[model samples]
Target: MVMGYVSGAVVFLVGLLGGVGLGIACRQYWVEKRNRQTREQAASVIAEARKEAETIKKEAILQAKDTLFQMKAEFERESKESRKEFQNLEKRLLQKEENLDKKSEALDKRETTIGKREKLILQQEKEIGDKEKELDAIMDEQRRRLENLSGISSQEAKEMLIRMVENEARHEAALMVKKIETEARETSDKKAKNIIALAIQRYAGDYVAEKTVSVVNLPNEEMKGRIIGREGRNIRAIEASTGIDLIIDDTPEAVILSGYNPIRREVARVSLERLISDGRIHPARIEEIVEKVNLEVENSIREAGEQAAFDVGVHGIHPEIIKLLGKLKYRTSYAQNVLQHSREVAFLCGIMAAELGLNEKHAKRAGLLHDIGKAIDHEMEGPHAIIGADLAKRYGESHVIVHSIAAHHEDVPAEDILAILVQAADALSGARPGARKELLETYVRRLEDLERIASSFSGINKAYAIQAGRELRIIVESDMVSDSEVVLLSRDIAKKIESELSYPGQIKVTVIRETRAVEYAR
Candidate 1:
């Protein structure tokens, strides 16, 4: 029974194994068939793709060729049109050239005709000149014959007539000139007085005491000794640093800083004040304070200058120029602060310019900067007017301002009314009563110079500077100078006086040329 069961089981197991093996073989066959089908589909797809590519390539090539043919046709058509245009243009240009050639030939002919006409005109002019010369000779011969018949030599007759005419003309001209001068003086003097009086009445300024040196007040008189220090070392250090002399005298609570250089004196005064205020009297402290105060003072100077310019309504001034103007505060001219003088000049200029119907602001600006050179006149080597003009120009001042400043003293001749106004204002300000004083030596020298200048001119018999050297009366030999010549002589004398001497205002120059018949009186 077990053997039958084992055989049945083996038969069942073999059948099961054979069935599994057959199923595996069939599955492999199906997979291989499916792979073959896929390969075939892929090959067919590749063939179709190649065919489509070839068709597309052929279509593209055909289109390209068609486009090329169209382009060639268009190029040919454009070339044809361009050739036609070129030929037409060339033909027109040739025609124009021909016309131009013809016009040129015609112009050449006209030029030749003009040249002939000019030659003919020149020939006619020469003939006319020849005829004129012939006529002149004939007239001269006739005139000589007429003079001989009249029993008068040509020179003697001319002299007699000229003398008679000169006598009449001299009397008439003198009368006219004197009348015109008198009228002009009458009108001008009245107008001038009015303007000057009006300006003076309008502007009023307080008198300020001018100080050439600055004084720094100390806390006590004992502090003065400390400033002197051991062996006067402190004072020496300050002088060396500032180029100023510190005078620690018995004056209570006061130390005087003296220097010809206003800028140096100002710097020294500031430094000393700082030192006294800080209570540090050592050399190092002195130097530090000095340097700091100097910088501060420099800034103050610049601000003061800028403020002055602003106050006067001037602009475009350089910072350096502003600093220079600030230095004028320490400058004194004739016991008046130069800065104040400049301000006064500026005000006077504005008033004068307004009255004269000129550019008032520009005039005021020029006046304000006119004496700027006084700030550094001691350091520089030239007239303050010229130096100031140069500084104004360098500081970007207008050409008009520079001109007016330069011409304030007539140093370069007044170019405009503004320049003349600047001069007049400056003269008025400086020449006012008690504004300036003249040294006796300078006054005498100036008078001598005036007389010498008048005497140097020809036709001057006696030259005297009268009226406290304000008036120059020059006498000319009556035979040498006529009345008109006397007027001219006065002008020349005035010009020479201006050139020679530096005086306050305008000087009166009188040239007297008088003739007297002394025999009848005897």
Candidate 2:
């Protein structure tokens, strides 16, 4: 029974194994069939996609062909238009060339015509030249005949005509010159008088005449002996220290101080007076007093200069210049106080400058410094005007001011209106009556000399000194002195006076020539 059971079990196991294997085979077959179907479907889809790709490529190629054909046609059309434009440009160039050829031909013809005309003009010029030569010869013949008939050569006739014309012209020019000179003189005289009168009227300055000597009154005659000191040492010391001469003359209680230098004379005078008052007279005391008085006088001079400048409203003067200007206070020119005269000149210059519309301050400055040289004129050898100008220039004065100072006395040429104004003011200041004093005999002698010098001229009939000898009027015989000769005569007389006499300022020389015709009416 065990064996049969084991056999049946084995059979059952075998059947079970077979059944499992068959099911596995059936499943693998089904999977393979499904894979085959899937592959077939995939292959069919790929083939259909390939056919669509081929159809799209053919359509693209046909579109490319059509685009290329259109581009070619457009290129051909542009080429045709370019060719047509080229043909038109060629035709225009040909037409321009033909026109240029025609114009060149015309220019050639015009050149030929111009050449013919130039030849004709040259022939005409030659003919005119020959005709002119013939006319010149004819003119020469006629001139020779005329000259012979006139008994004078052509040159002589021309000279005579020229002389006649020149004489007439000279006479006319003389008349015109005289008329213009008369009118100018009238106008200038009136204007000058007005200006001078206004200047004199505007400023009136006090006149002080200065002298080279100063007289100091002493207490008694005994003071003179004491001043003279032992062995005359005191007076000698005073002279040595002060550069002045002390004259203790036999005058009553008066000591006369004498020096060419007014400033030194002043210092000496003051020092001696101080010594007399102090009653101490010796060389040492005399020197001390002189030194002190010199300082005082110098201070006074500076003050005077400053005062003059202040009065004139001028400032910025150098200290040394101011001191020199102060020295003028004691200086005298022809007995007129130089400082006073300078002040008067300053005022007059200022007034006249204002009237003439010039620089008033500059005028006043020039006037104030016009006589600065007078301070040191005794030491320096030159005209005071030139010395003053040099001082002003050295002290940094303006060129105009320097020139004005120099030309104030005509030492230099007056180059500007300010120079002329300074001259006029200086003249007015010194030339005024009583401004300067001279001996009466000297005055009469100067006038007589002026008249005599003027009368010495040949044509002068009479010579009269007028304006206090400032002017010499000479009457000339009309027959002897012509209108032109009077001018020469006046100049000669002026020159003679200048050489013969020494006078202050300038003297006017006037020559008068008059013609008189007497006719009786019955």
Candidate 3:
């Protein structure tokens, strides 16, 4: 029984193993079949997708070709149009080139014609020159024959004719000069009179004539002795301090202060009077008084300068210049106060400038500064006018003002209207009657000298000094002096007077030549 049971179990185990093998084989077969089917479906889908892709690729290729063809055709059309336009432009350019060539040819022809005309003109000019030479020769020959017939050379005849013409021209020129002078004098006199009168009427300044010396009266004669001090110490101190000389003469309680500088003299006079009144007569006292008086006088001078500028309505003067102007207050020109004279000149300048339609303020400024040099003339060299001009220039005055200052006294030529105005104003101020004074002896001597100079000239029979020695009238012998000789004689006398004498303003020299015809009746 054990054997049979083992056999049956083995068979059963065999069957079970066979069954399990069969099931695994069947499952493997099914899986293979399914895998084949899946592969076939995938293949088909891949083939269809490939065909669709090919179709899309073809369509894209066709569209690209069509676009390329259309673009090429459009480009061809545009190129054809452009080529046609270019051909038209080329034709137009060729026509313009032909026109330019024709114009060039016409210009060449015109240039040739102009060259021929120039040659003809040159030939005509040469012919004209030849004819002119021939004509000149013939005319010269005729002139020579006429000269020989007249018994005079051509040059001599020409000289005679020139002399005649010159004489006639000279006479006419003299008449014209006289006429012009008359008219000018009449107009100038009226204008000048009006202006001067207006100036004088507007200004009423008092004339103060300063003397060279100033007097200081003392309280008693004993004061002189004290002022003299021991060995003249006090007087020396006073003189040294004031730059003046104290004249302690026996003049009865008075001392004379002498100085070339009026300011110094004034200072000395004031200082001495103060010392006398205070009863202090020492060198220290003298110096102290001098310093005090100097300061006072300086203040006075500054006030005067300010007043002068105020009166003239001029401003913007430099302080240093104003100080120098103030010094003019103490200055005197021929006994005429220089400051007063400057004021008069300024007024006159203003009036004249107004009438002439010039800058009145500028004119007045120039006039006021014209004589500024007189303030320090003794300390410097050169004419006052030139010195004043230099001062003005150094102090930054305008060129016009500097020139006017220099020319006012004729030190330099009056080149500007302002200069001329200043000159005229200066003359009006200085040349008025009694405006200035000279010593009687000098005045008489000047008149005598003027007469003597006039008489010294040749052909002058008599000489007379008239118009306060401003004019010299000389009588010439009729036989000795012709009209021209009389003129020359007058000029000679004037030149001699100018060289030998010094006079103010100007001198007029007149020479008279008169012929008398007398027959005795029996």
Clashes of each: 0, 0, 0
TM-score of each: 0.44, 0.46, 0.47
Residue pairs in collision within model 1? none
lDDT of 3 by residue, 1-522 (tens): 999999999999999999999999999999999999999999999999999999999999999999999999999999999999999999999999999999999999999999999999999999999999999999999998998899999789889999999998998798658656766787678668855643432232332223556888888888889989999998889878987877788899888876666788888888887887788789988888889999999999888898899999999998778888899988766667889999999999999999999999999999999998777766776767898999999998999999999998677888989999998999888766668674456678988999888777667789899987888888998888898787678877876886677655678988888898999999
Candidate 2 regions with alpha-carbon error over 4 angstroms: 1-210, 439-522
**lDDT for each candidate structure:** 0.82, 0.85, 0.85
Candidate 1 per-residue lDDT, tens place, 184-277, comes to: 8876786688556433322223211234457888788889889988898888888888878776777889987765666777789878877887
Worst 10 residues of 3 by lDDT: 200-209
Clashes by residue pair, model 2: none
Q: Output the worst ten-in-a-row residue range by lDDT, candidate 1.
A: 200-209
Instruction: Kindly report which residue stretches of model 1 are placed more than 4 angstroms away from their true locations once superposed.
Output: 1-212, 218-221, 249-254, 437-522
Model 3 segments more than 4 A misplaced: 1-210, 438-522
After TM-score superposition, the amount by which residue 258's alpha carbon in candidate 2 deviates from its true location, in angstroms, is: 2.0
Clash number for candidate 3: 0
**Model 1 TM-score relative to the real fold:** 0.44
